[model samples]
Each structure stands twice: as C-alpha cells, then as structure tokens.
Target: MLHVYIEPVPKGQWGPIDGYRIETQDGTRLSGELLRSERLAVSQAKLHGYVPLLATVRIPDKAVAEHWTPADKAPVTV
Candidate 1:
C-alpha cells in the first residue's frame, strides 16, 4: 500500500488542484485530486482515493506505488 494524498480542485477554482496533501505513515509523499464522493467516503474510511488525477511516489518498504508512471498524461482515477 502506497501513501496517497487527496487534494481538492476547489468548488470554482480552475487549476491542477485546490488544497490538501496526503503522506504515508513513514513520510512518503503523494499528490492528486480527490472527488467529492470520495471525500465523503474518506471521512468514514479514513483513507482517500486518488482519482481523476494522481501522482504516486515510491516508498522503500512501507508501500508500493503502482499503475502511475511519468509518461502517462491522462488523469488517474482510483
């Protein structure tokens, strides 16, 4: 499991994202956008899903960052 961060794009803002950051328990950094639905779910689950747009940074032993690559340009929805 990789550390995932879910940032929002704001209600009316336009850009890569709005605010927020997710990090692994060990301090690995990941960034991306979180959907409203997912945001609601996170309050219940305590975990956020990186969807529509996501960036995963590899961690050594705690979690593995999969499916994301530098060459990929489309948004990644979890």
Candidate 2:
C-alpha cells in the first residue's frame, strides 16, 4: 500500500466535502475535490492495512501530479 500524507485545505472550493491536499510519492500531489465518501475511504485506507495493491489509490481526489504548491507549504491537519 502507498502511504501518503493527507492535509486539509482550509481555503478550498470543494464545498462541504472540504478540500484536502494529498502528498504522494515521487513529489506528486493533488488538491481536494473528493466527495465525502471518497475522502473517508482514502482516510480509512491509509489507516487500515487491508488495502490491496491493485486497489491502491493515488492522492488528491484522483488528480495525481508532481505536487501541490500549497501542500508543500501548508501545515497538516489530522
């Protein structure tokens, strides 16, 4: 499983779902646009050790990238 750093986006525009900037491997990152369920799923996956490699998810609401500028500078929550 790919362990990632999850951080909330306080100034995001994803409505009540809340935006978060996820940090992934190889300097990749993405900004929040996840539905509440999706966010919860990712969070749970990170916490639990039962995720399959094929089912592993990359970060930031499925928009994998080299990195998110704010995530690098922003403080982490939870």
Candidate 3:
C-alpha cells in the first residue's frame, strides 16, 4: 500500500497545498502539482498511470483554519 501525505502549503489558487507528495510502501516519494487534491490526488496520480497509494494524513481536527495542512493521519483512504 502507498502512503500519500498531502502537505498543504500556500502557493497556488488553493491554500494548504504545499504540493502533492505520495510515498510508496517501499518508501519512495513522488512529487507533482497535478497531485494537488487529496480527494482527486490519488485518482489524478492513477489517471496519470500511477498506482494509488493508501493515503493518510492528520491535519488540525477542526472545521476551519487559516490554511489547511496534512501533517497528520486523520483523513484516510483505502
């Protein structure tokens, strides 16, 4: 399984999107701007012919924040 860690940073039109970084089960890290959305990030990667990884991250467990970040494993995917 791949572990995708979405580290959000202020850069583009979206906030907290440092850039899409996905880690493989073997511990390889891939970076790209196309991998921006955690929701569609995996699919985007896969659509690009990337095998989607088991995504996991833990940001501030709150409804709102100045900017969202993926520094933890709260929102997870199978």
- For candidate 3, give the lDDT: 0.43
Q: Rank the candidates by lDDT, best first.
A: 3, 2, 1
Candidate structures ordered by TM-score, highest first: 3, 2, 1
State each model's CA lDDT, in order: 0.37, 0.39, 0.43
TM-score list, all predictions: 0.22, 0.28, 0.35
lDDT of 2 by residue, 21-67 (tens): 44454435542454243345345445554231111222344244333
Minimal lDDT window, size 10, model 3? 54-63
Provide the clashing-pair count of each candidate structure. Answer: 3, 1, 9
| Top candidate by TM-score | 3
Candidate 3 TM-score to native: 0.35
Residue-level lDDT tens digits of model 1 in 1-78: 232433333523555543444444454444344444433423322434333223343222223345333213434343
Question: Model 1 off-target regions past 4 Å?
Answer: 1-18, 32-78
In model 3, residue pairs whose N, Cα or C atoms come closer than 3 Å (at least 3 residues apart or on different chains), thus clashing, are: 8-16, 9-16, 9-17, 9-18, 57-72, 57-73, 57-74, 58-72, 58-73
Which of candidates 1 and 3 is the stronger one according to TM-score?
A: 3
